[model samples]
Target chain A: MAELTTLREAIAGLVHDGDTVALEGFTHLIPTAAGHEIVRQGRRDLTLVRMTPDLVYDQLLGMGVARKLVFSWGGNPGVGSLHRFRDAVERGWPAPLEIEEHSHAGMANRYVAGASNLPFAVLRGYVGTDLASVTPTIRPITCPFTGEELMAVPALRPDVTVVHAQQADRAGNVALWGITGIQKEAVLAARRAIVTVEEVVDAFAPRPFQVVLPGIAIDAVAVVPRGAHPSYAHGYYDRDNAFYTAWDPISRDRDAYRAWMQRHVLDVDDFAGHLASLAAVA
Target chain B: MTAWDTDEVMTIVAARELRDGAVCFVGIGLPSEAANLARATHAPRCVLVYESGTIGAKPEVLPLSIGDGVLADHADAVVSVPEIFNYWLQAGRIDVGFLGAAQIDRHANINTTVVGSYAEPKVRLPGAGGAPEIAASAGEVVVVLRHTTRALVDRLDFVTSVGHGTGAGARDALGYPGRGPVAVITDLGVLRPDPATRELTLVAVHPGATADQARAATGWPLRVADDLAVTSSPTGEELAVLRDLRARTAASRGGPTRPVRPTGR
Candidate 1:
């Protein structure tokens, strides 16, 4: 397995053009910096999938890096700005995005099923509703054992999955101590996985049993402290409202957003410089 | 206090008696915040059911709405609205159905489907999602609404879900297994049913409210509970969190635009 040797080179190396990429984090618990880096670096036609996208999706969508997006829900908390998305829906953009609306369980279950290398997994979720409204790519067949009809959510084997972890070791094994059920499944379902950590540990054993993502599933680790800035790490930090508001996808002016991007992201290629610029602005 | 202050009181009044593990079929705004607070503090195991299929949602932040990823992303399991209603809720699982109202009557009846006549009337609401099924099948209903004479009318433009209509043991006679609409919680006070005629009776009042004030807000002969309790005001902590969530939610959609408030339908 090719290990991530350096932070700057790792992200650039792992992520490729025209690949289906699924990102980790949501809303305020965003993978802000790395996501901005990916977007500003101009990764194009890269199908981006987030459980429920917000600013990251908007920034990328607005910038035209993402060609297609598959998600359950889009738009920010209250004043969700899926306007670029709206315009894409109303007046087709780069490549009119395809929206797949369903519950989070249904969205992740497909990945879970894929990760386990199972033919299909039976779930009693979304049995009766408009969730069946979104025409799925796969069709269902009757279960012989119970005679109950089972839905077949297609396998989600993304080309690459980028996740933000709370901590990681030198050998690439990761540990995420926050709300995590989707992460385990996501890391496995993808062909390649990149784990960004808040700190790097050297053969350091985790004191808490719950803190781990065994070495086998992980391939590359990038140690970037305060990695989950906008995204809180369980009880570590409260949501940075100033940071969130600064990147307010719903209300931010185009020019201001462009400037924010230029100064914080485009102007710098590395995390340190990005942090420095962010500090300079702050 | 001001009218919005009254609304906040009404919101808390409904949340007062929440028990653990209740499958609260929630909508957005006040209901969502109340549901989350009840879960976070009072009822740890409170299974917050949403229309978007999230059940037992433990969101890090107060979800902006039912469809907020925080709802399902952190939920125990997500079920379809039909299954949420048909199997879990209507199949007799939900403990208490917490709901807000645009209008109420002395009979504890609610109107959310339409404002005027069914076919051609005044306003059209977001439409009946799972409210009909929930009202019909939940263990019991606990309604939260601001008490205004116009809101607490003698008659409804439409019967969204039969809470307690004009008769005694009517819902029981109709074969509703669950005890329906035990109380109507409002900014003014809490109202229960009179055992004899199933008419609504004032059961509790807020800190500053009086029985006469609650009576004035109703259009019919409002019955009185034997010993009514006064609902405490939102504490500083409660206000801080609720207000923070409210402010965030309000400012979320590009800072507040004029809200469409007519839902007597």
Candidate 2:
């Protein structure tokens, strides 16, 4: 239960370049601030996954920090386009980039099934139509015992999973309090897990069930209060819908996006300056 | 049935269930054609929601995948992936989840990941995307696959998504309740859950299907509904409309995928 001297030191130790990482926050979930820091550090060849909501995926794509993306549906309405991924796919832009499309619950189930190590778990889903060809990860194979056909879903395991939590203790057990999309699975499936907390509580042992992610699965924890700025926490700051509408227009045009990023994200060494710059734009 | 056979009956079946104003989450291939047929005939207002984020898609033909251009070519509105899931799907506004299957067990669980063992897979199909979410959140899910032994499995290689969640009782235990499956419309017939077990039970027999044939094709002990009904053979009226729709669709750039079901039976 040792507290790190600095946030950058904690993050640098947990991450290595070209690693496959899964971020905890959605497009609107500012839990991404930690990951944005990683990107700013010049990580490359990252295969990022969007479990469900993926407004931020475009940002990753636009910045080129994200080379390979695994997701069902990842896009923004007004500004960003599926054109990048599509173009990459046409030319295999990010080599070995795989697109697996399915419903939200379906994506979660596959991950859960992988985490549980269950050979197969049955659910009455996709009964009447053709959502079967989203990805080639799972295929129908004849059951040797019964000779019946079964849909074989693949297992997903990321190299590292970085999640932002509401609170945590020095021990690294953090609280996510629902609205956690595949966070548990990310922790369960990844080789290493990092939990970033808004605040570190000293009296964490007072409550038990409040702990969402256990310390056993966590390798490191970073405490950054109100770190989920720009991206809001659930019911905290409302989603920066302004960001959503603005991201595409800025990123869609390469020159404009690069200029905006240089002005907003890059060239600022400190978080305070970054925050102030973002505020100026808003 | 071969393309000649499936062409007649498949079109007839697709036209009936789909109607105007229905919001259908379309699968890529055959379903794209079926829904398009419905749109051409009587369901002009049926909105097609592709998993790639295009909603209210009226593709000219079937799409190869969700990323197919036609899905977005004739769209009403397009939103972000997160919004589509957080707002529309997980929020449960979609009426139908049109899907295909590689393997379907007794409970209708699907596998879209691998064909062999995970440690070293023999075949890696596409991984599960949002299929589980669709099954869990759609008003109801519709499975469209060719009736055969390979697809109608006793067990799946990998359970892609839980359609009913370990049969009937488990759904309630799981807490997040969904409408689950309404029907699994296949080239052979239609399937529904058993009254007592909620396991997939043969509810309708197609014109060419027999109890013995269905049993022979199943990987499990095929159970027929107590009041199983025979699907009507394609009549001239139905065939004409179906053929016309298929011609227009196939001729159009956006028709469905190859109307071919591999004979794994």
Candidate 3:
């Protein structure tokens, strides 16, 4: 059974230095609060993994919390570059970050393979692309029956997987809707899983396209309303697009990046405090 | 008629490529706008599949990102990311893969990865998201980007997605499923692959753009069709719908009326 806990406690209990951690949310339901907590707790050398390493990973990368990133794409979504990520890769500002890249299909399948407890997943991908040449995990395999050649990627089994959701029942069953992305596979693929939800509800009414992660699969359920903040939580709030655009300038300069992190993420006691600080500034 | 910029004409031309009821797997930025414009204008039944797993997404306003709540809220179905890639894309259920790239070569090969070396870089672009598989697996592919010497290069710094590989028979030899890039639409005009050589050739230029300008903009030894057609200007209705879409998107994002140009990934 999953324990109901605070975001800080969940991060402290689940994440560790040098762990392979996945904070999975495609473009919505991103675990921003959990990522912030990981930054606050001062974890180091984590192999931070996500399909799209959005603002949260940019923060973690800027703080030197990750020594490596295993992802498909690292960008500010509709915005341009994740400046901190670019800095880390280009100049090694905070650290010389190593990256193991894959295409979205490859990454998603890796998670699916991991969730299925399979050794590797096969797909008709990377046939003529440079990805197969660079990524060590991608290799060619021949189909025994049809004699067709395909690509195989090793399963991604993270040490901890963290996600943000809309609600968690009293029984710690997490229910999320609206672009659930790869959260379920990420959670199932990890040795430990943490879910930060907008609220703890009595029971799930079960919305369309809803995914419910039973308490048995989760390690902890943290109630942090609006945990996805800059990223939206479907019905809870809209995506803060201005903040995403605002991040560009703040992350471009090292000093501004540091100052922003110090003020918004590090100095705050928790996510609520972080929200309060932003509100005060606004 | 209302005046339309090159970017506007480029979007209109790209939107016109999609057939009614065609399933287009949309990349963010230009391709998204074009696909949405097609749905809003001529091809109302055109299905938009976003990488975020929103299949057949019909958004009222342009989405700031692929996984915006509007996409999911209006989608026919929302599947897991793995399923979207595996069951839909890799399974060849998609009819078209509409993409934009930082760099494209003579063969329509793309580079959204890096500017210099992979080991040590000048600029580290966002690596391949779904472009590789989309470029490989869709029935056909459509590329949309601004026409510049920097983008329409002789050779890519890195081949993030293979269009026709080296040239004709390359995709076939490599056993790629898709029919590579059928059209490379840009601000200047449209370049379709040469049926024999599979090299992208300038088939049409926009009204104000000349073949010489297109040639000057491309890094390679550009090829032009024998009877290169000058594209028609954007119709009033097309411009109105596109501008309205942009205005609504900008308003929702709390920005200026014009949608910002996407910086290369």
DockQ of each: 0.10, 0.07, 0.81
Clash numbers, per candidate: 7, 60, 0
User: Model 1, stretches more than 4 Å misplaced?
Assistant: A26-29, A78-84, A90-95, A138-141, A203-211, A249-252, B1-6, B20-29, B36-265
Residues B113-223, candidate 3: write the lDDT tens digits. Answer: 998998888999988999999999999999999999999998898899999999989999999888989999999999999999999999999988999999999999999
Which segments of candidate 3 are over 4 A away from where they belong?
B257-265
Give the range where candidate 3 chain B is weakest over 10 consecutive residues by summed lDDT. B256-265
Give me the displacement of residue B151 in model 3, in angstroms.
0.5
The stretch of ten residues in a row with the least summed lDDT in candidate 2 chain A is A75-84
- Specify the poorest-scoring 10-residue window by lDDT in model 1 chain A: A124-133
lDDT of each: 0.63, 0.61, 0.92
Query: Tens digits of per-residue lDDT for model 2 on A1-282?
Result: 334334566567766778877775533334555655775687777887656334445445556676667665444322223433433444443343545555454455556665677654333334332445445554555667976544555566778877777777666677753234456776777777777677777754442113267787778787766566545454334334455455655654657766776786677764556677888876
True contacts kept of 3: 0.86
Candidate 2 overall lDDT versus native: 0.61
Model 3 lDDT per residue over A1-282, tens place:
799998888888889999999999988999999999999999998999999999999999999999999999989888788999999999997889988999999999999999999999999988878878888999999999999999999999999999999999999999999898999999999999999999998989968999999999999999998899899998899999989988999999999999999999999999999999999988
Choose 1 or 2, whichever is better by DockQ: 1
TM-score of chain B of each: 0.87, 0.87, 0.97
Q: Chain A in model 3: its TM-score?
A: 0.99
